[model samples]
Target: MNDAGPSSSHPRCDQIAVIGAGAWGTALAAAAARAGRNVRLYARRRQTADEINTTRRNDAYLGPLALPDEITAVTAMDDAVRGADAVLLVVPSSAIRETARDLENCVPRNVPVVICAKGVEPGSGLLLCDVVAEEMPDQTIAVLSGPTFADEVAADMPTSVCIASSPVPGEPVGEGTAAQLALALSAGSFRAYVSDDPVGVEIGGAMKNVIAIACGISRGAGFRSNMTAALITRGLAEMTMLATALGGRAETVAGLSGLGDLTLTCSSEQSRNLRFGLQLGAGTSRQEAFGGAPVIVEGVRNAVSVTDLARKHGLSLPICEAVRAIVHDHADIGTTLGDLWAQPLEFESNAHDTTFRHPDANMARERIEELIG
Candidate 1:
């Protein structure tokens, strides 16, 4: 870790180590470099590291986008994190555990590890942060999520994201860590907001991809804007319900990680989940929908995990469940869509008071059961 301690405000993060050299990882390295920090990016392949170092570009991921000289690519994970102030774990959701296990030996106890990948572990239904904690119990942890596109962020386009951190009961990570990380990554065209709700932020990031798939399916099925709008709105309701049930705040779901991410992902074709869903809705087979793309469509895997997570909480997420069926169960898309529309309609709100209120988890579960049953 850097010698600089957390400031009363805006702590210095001069050395940043980013593990994983995928598009998101490379873009984050660019963001950190743009923030005037020395960034060490770790790539699995020697070729990728060599390309970034010699050509000043990660042609495989970012194409011809020029990376700042401040960013250095390394093939070794230990080389990336050694003496770094903070570390960003930018690997895929499925790789979170293995990556964290590998990082456990390299990262310092005091330095915070920011989990940039978004998804629940299909096996354990654990959030990526928890998976990291399980592997690196002594390390401080945080999460970064929001409506971000790797290409746009790499181009230094205006982007805003939320960085959420909360100290575990006996963990070394303090509340100030999240703010410091936000400061470390905030550049001229990139904005980072700090939040204490890591659970909400992570859930929002994961669930949005699944919701975006739902929206894409709607669009690909020839549904108009109204259907997309409905899916987005209802998808948020499902997100809020599951997030709150899992100890996250409903208000957090309304913020950047939740509502903001959901809106951006569902509204754009840049999202891989949406594109995959589009293919499925257009009568492409599941295997064919993937179509040899290198990019992982997180929603395909997350649909199952999210649905299982909801069932574990006794909550029903119709949109996510429908997606899970179509993507994994080999269910007919048209029939699944029809079944979703056939569900019983109920009040959108549980409160009748003067002030508006989102449904609590219990009320949400009850309402969902009524609709589904």
Candidate 2:
């Protein structure tokens, strides 16, 4: 891949503030720096900031990979976003609301705040983008998601991601903000595709983690590739249903943020969600599956939120429900697996059905009506 520098056609974002110094955040900082943008990486801990500034490495999250000199580590949130043209909130999904709330007073209203985390909010069942919007109402919100691995991206390996921007209700859409941000981050090895479907992009990013756990459980339980393939296909259908119900385009679900991310997360052991599922399927307790460290397995938490969101739309996401049962409800894996296998057969596609077929059909009908109206 040719390292195409920032495009001259779009508005240039010369400085990017990446909130969080975890693997993904550090990797994004590297990518932005590689694209010739100065990067300020915000770390919660002074020690982390000092380590990265002193060594140009975030060994805690990114091993020995040396970051570009254009990247600087900052401990103060205000300092990080002070002059940043764009802010990439790469913190965990659970931290998004709080982080955005903190940034409300810091990030300039004109600067775009891109959400880089996945997973629905556990209690509100709100997408992370929505969570950010609620906190930073004046900021242009976008989402970046796809089949990306932090290690590979940090190493300058070829990667493609979708960056989607959508206007908040009652606000004018930023016609070229996604494209401009894409231009800022684009490189020979790092490609960014722009879209207007933050809803679809975020849905894909969040739900894929839940589906990955299901895939991991299936694989760990000795199911063949056939089972994994079935789960992935059906899981995607569920994703499309929820996304469209929430006003996202179906085509977006087929793009890099949706199917692309789903495939990568489900197939790779590098995904913490998949690894957690594997441990669960291999008879490890949920608490033990965490391996006693402060690792965030997004799917485990998202299972609850995804299922909740699906219920809100009156959609049936069987695989996600199964994961929720096993992970949260502590239902026996054997029983859950049996329950899944025993479900009655139905038409594979509901394209012709005017109404969704579910126990909460009325709710689904009303929600769809609200969305369309």
Candidate 3:
């Protein structure tokens, strides 16, 4: 019942519940609190909740960064979601289904649930949004994704993300709008743009992690910016292709969630996926590469999932496949990269052309540009 009406131009619900105590979740809670909204952050452990509440920090995740006073940490699930105007699920991709199921009992039926985790379900290969819909059929769902680093956003750095959600079914006049969801999450330094292409946003967010690993490997293997550029461009093509086949717009990949995120994650030392790939390139064992790491490098898991999803569509995602082979199959990084580069090349098409873009995206970038610009 907290759903925002479609006609509201500056739609934003005030009370927000964020599920998960990880770095990203804490960062978002801080952003909301900075926006002067009542925000509740859920942590599974009472100690974690206590630390965040009493110390105004998440020691394990944010590492002593002060949280805004308006943010409250909650240990009880019901207490977190009760009377919330919006809900953000920021857990890892593997936990999406379980988390959504738990929320079915607590979340109001119409409160928009924004998914911040990125990846495809391993065995089923379903996108996280689809998985959530299956678990919480009565709830409205949206996805938030872009070139975000948790610490940067928490520090109030200027950042932008795309929000994609379907309008409430069959409610022609008063649907739960994605713009409303975006407005609710946006703050002074944090901006949100609404989109209809959840598939594109989700795929872009998931695949970039895999590509960041590849970029890290190239850098660690003594390659320069030339190789990184090549890999990034080709990787975008692969991502655009796969996203298009799976009912997403190709131009969406060129937007913040795809191109923007790809550039940021691949080049930054702060990225866990890139760091993990650096270890792989330096000849470390998988266990040693991620040993005692606090954050989850999504690429390690997404590599396998992306490869499988590509194969299902009879497509060749060379970079993703190589990352998987190196990370999972123990294949030699040199041999994998060599083979990937040895493949025959094709002419580069304009990214906006119909031949290159997804068929489902009948709308133009001009429309989206108008919205954001």
Error of 2 at 321 (Å): 0.4
**What would the TM-scores of all predictions be?**
0.90, 0.90, 0.88
Please report how far candidate 3 places residue 277 from its true position, in Å.
Answer: 0.6
Q: The CA-based lDDT of model 1 is what?
A: 0.87
Tens-place lDDT digits, model 3, residues 261-320? 999999899998888878777767778876755557889899999889999999878889
Query: Which segments of model 1 are wrong by more than 4 Å?
Result: 1-11, 167-175, 290-294, 350-373
lDDT of 1 by residue, 16-63 (tens): 999999999999999999999999999999999999999999998899
Candidate number that wins on lDDT, 1 or 3: 1
What's the distance in Å from true for residue 174, model 3?
10
Off by over 4 Å in 3: 1-12, 167-176, 290-295, 350-373
- Model 1: colliding residue pairs: none
The TM-score obtained by model 1 is 0.90
RMSD in Å for all candidates: 6.3, 7.7, 9.1
